[model samples]
Target: MFSPALLQMILVAALLSLLSAGKLTASDYYVATTGNDQNPGTLNQPFRTVARGISSARQPGDNVIVRKGIYPQARTLNLANPGTADNYISLKAFEEEEVIIDGSNLQKDATLIAVLSHHIRIQGLTVRNSQNIGISIWGPGTRVHAVEVSGNRVHHCQNSGIYAGFNRLHDPVRDLLIEDNVISECSLMNEGGRYNQWSFGAGAGLSRKVTIRNNTVSHCYGEGIGLYLSNKGTIEGNTVHDNFSVNIYLDNTTNTRVSRNLVYSTEDQRFYRFNHPASGIQIANENYQGFNNPSSHNVITNNILIGNYIAISSGSYQRGGGLKHTLIANNTAWGSIGPLLHIDADTSHYKSRISNNIFKQTGNVPLTDIQGSTARIEFSNNLWHGGVPQQSARSTSDLEADPQLINGGSFNPEAYRLSESSPAHNAGIKLPEVEQDFNGKPRSKNFDIGAW
Candidate 1:
């Protein structure tokens, strides 16, 4: 038998052999504004342009650290190299410095940074001023999975600030994470042009397990954060506001979860004459030629929808699309001119549940919740301000008393906490799927009526 030290030496020799053969070897390349491409991409002699770093030879676990400066040469930080799952190709700003990749003058392409490969991590940078998309991720040839686009500021784009789309059903951009980023002032060209696909803060297309969380997406011309033909992901803990269209939109999605998001002010100030919809949250069959597919098996929970044109809605086209096994629970909505919850579909056979939500409208608009026939309506324990149980209402367990909300008339919408003496303090039926309250706190022994 070989000795333990001898065995370890043999393994180390094998690893060194692989490194010498360039299979397990990874490099650290640097880029700076004062660098020269002719120099070796080291700390002292870095590459001048992002394209030069992209053109360099890189293996898995390689890093391209960009220094702090304005990269005037608008170029595509293309990911042509694939990384391993354990060790990804990292493209990050130097020590959390401000690395601005400005694409204002670039006319060659619509996207600034393009992710064509797999297992890439792009973080801690500012991507802005593109004609179309600020950062575009497309799995063109093979499957591009496990990409993390985090801690960056993506804004001021024409169509979408960040668009991750994969048309190939087999090879898709799956297992993606877009978190903790500020995406604002996007979709400048497509203001209220929903049919034109003009503007969106962030969008995911034809992907699975793509989480969009802990981000601030606001002031866009289209949806603040949209999932088009995408399914099975969590859109949670996001502050989404002030979009021309829906603040958070899910089109043709299945088994999706949207929880603990602060969605407010989906007001179309740009094209008010065009009469944009501007719903706070929409789960529907629209966009991307996917209007007819079944948008079912979804959950919208623990969201705070405030001061929007419409709080929540689900729309179906003429092609007979609808929702099934959907749940809208524990949300807080106020100051909406339209219906608090409007669900319309072509088919009468729908199964949806609305429970433990708060509906308080300051305006005189009628407080109505739509339900189609054959819908398993569970509208119970909802706290409505100045609301009376009507004959047309379905839930007999609902309460028509004041919720006793706090500081709702103030400038800060986050002050909609339930008062200690409020009727909404502990009046909800807690679902097993909903473990945390809207404030991410542990639910009390008796759950609250609406989102905290």
Candidate 2:
């Protein structure tokens, strides 16, 4: 005989199973290659246009599924609706399907997808071959928040691959996530979009709490990744290469963290003719307008820079232009030119901390401090080799020893790491940010000089 308590427990388990399996209340609308826009958005008889599917999603828990095909729309797909915290409007490719949103026929300056609202997710699609940005999100008239752009292939765009929050008179975007996207071949070739200066591969201007992670950005005529005035953001685990101006640029940003990213340079010789040098990372305050916000409280750590003209630059030359309280640590810089590390400013209050970094130059004057005529710089525990050899700034801990790395005289990615027998090992100043090496290996308690 079964006990009454045991039967009650069995009945409760069965009721919970029914509620968990049948709890889905959201609808899934489909868009296909062979369907008409006049059809109801069902699985078999779906809508043809992506815009039609978006219009038919009546609630926040609705999803718009696009099938595998070439969507050759020439106009912008504007997402103007908002979703709640529990539910978001998702526009994505069908399961394991290859959906290509080809914007080859779009007019110049016409963006492909513009998300003007919050709680939207765009993923697993190919958005490419456009005249302007592949995807953009902004609330020009008001504030927008919580956007996720991931797992997409954006390429061959004439301007930026993915741009955010660069409009005029707009409230800054908050809580943005851009990750695992392959963005390349954004040719900013002076087509009236960027006449004076070119666009970026992926970037945001006037945003906060943004995260850019694990993306591959290459072959850009402008900077690879630029965050202008984007505060409290993090750039991590991205590979940025083959850019014209600088691989990564932070202009007038505050409280930003850049870490574990690989930045290298490529020569096209076009920038040389225009009197521009290929730089790796630059933090400046030259482009601010009425808002004269300083670049402060930013940290750059555990990066690998190879084959660049300048490894990293800080501060500025104009009046009231400089960085304050920035930290640069645990990076490997190999094969650069023209003062591989330069910090120049016209003010005395420019302050920066450079530590535990490896600077191996291609015979360039690796550094010029102040150019410290007046700036406050704290540089220490770094390894320097083979530059034009400028007089280094004063530091408590300095090492001119040869960093015994593998292929130590070349531009290989592993060339700047410390060998077991290297003098740089266990000879660096201990910094809080130097907890890891370039490969994310934990540093020793005694510390190893330079980025491993």
Candidate 3:
């Protein structure tokens, strides 16, 4: 004898099941030669192509772990579906091998690889040789977290190797972690098309709230780490070398910290058949007339800037310069084409604390610190390694004596032991340290010489 209450409970249970079934389920997909698309996408019965596997995956917590092989897609592998809060979709490599997603689409002129969906995680895959951007994230106002792109290689892409931001100007992609990925062999070009007519090569747009750490980025056509409207992000522990353009470019950003990154350019591997040099750590203002979107509240500290055109350049144009409140300290820049410190700001509102850095130039025109009427460019405790200083009638105060390094004008980590006779041994300002020691150790004594 079933009671009325029992019947009501059964009805509620059935309704709950219906609602739960509508949500995306946790399913796995494999990719191998001997696989089955018809069967359930399990380890044994894997799908052939990445597009097929990704399409069949349900939303929220649905994951596709591509095994070791080359997977080709007709168009971009679009992960634009909205995932639930609990169930986030993940596309990752099975064993961190050469899991290649070959995006050599000959039919299309340029493929815009956009990850427009929500709560997506992609890790450990080599995305290479695309006509457009290699791996991009266009998630608007969505939390994209724990995207571990480690131990993979990206090369010979036309556009940027890694891009994380929304397509729109205001909204930005947030909470991305790009670590230990080797990005090289990319060519930068000004392809006139849908891609914001003002786009440069590899490093040419806005990235936000992301951490680009410990990766070796080199041999690109544009900047090393391009902060286009990117803010509150930390870029450290990375080696950016051998790019055609600027190394670390900050445009229309604020509250970002770029510390301890080794930025320089070697003889370019020649992605394109051209011959031109580049700069290192170039910062400039964007939107000259319309928007006063200057990259404000940024800190450049403890970096090793070596062998480039210009070590660091502040402000965009010669007259239109008033980008203010930047901190440049404890950096060691050697063998540059232009001045070690070139500030083209117009006003004293361009306040900066330039302290305890080693500026060594092989060329004649050395440190050029342009002091405007309103600009208070505090020069304190900086060790002039070599070259004649740029003598200006404007006040450049507290310039320190030479803190001779053991190995003059050359960087060798093995012989980089701080000599007791060196003035730079303990000559750093006692500010809050942004980065740690070489082997991820704690840096307690104020700060180190350069980015460890």
Per lDDT, the best of the predicted structures is 1
Which residues of candidate 1, in runs, are more than 4 Å off? Answer: 1-24, 140-142, 192-195, 266-268, 271-277, 287-293, 369-374, 387-392, 410-414
Clashing pairs in 2: 369-372
Model 1 scores what on Cα lDDT?
0.78
User: In candidate 2, what are the lDDT values of residues 349-434, reduced to their tens digit?
Assistant: 44678787777765535444346453366778887777434454546577776777777545455766677888888877888866
Q: Is candidate 1 or candidate 2 better by TM-score?
A: 1
| lDDT tens digits, residue span 151-203, model 3 | 55777677777777655445666666777788876544432222323323333
TM-score of each: 0.90, 0.87, 0.85
Mark the 10 consecutive residues where model 3 has the least summed lDDT: 191-200
Clashing pairs in 3: 60-87, 61-87, 61-88, 206-228, 242-265, 347-375, 348-374, 348-375
lDDT of each: 0.78, 0.77, 0.65
Alpha-carbon error at 450 in model 1, in Å?
A: 0.6
Candidate 1 per-residue lDDT over residues 168-285, each given as its tens digit = 5445578888999999988877654555654468778777788999999988877888886777878999998878768898887778899999887645466332464478888776
Give the TM-score comparing model 1 with the true structure, all chains together.
0.90
Among these predictions, the greatest TM-score belongs to: 1
Q: How close to the true structure is residue 335 of candidate 1, measured as C-alpha lDDT?
A: 72
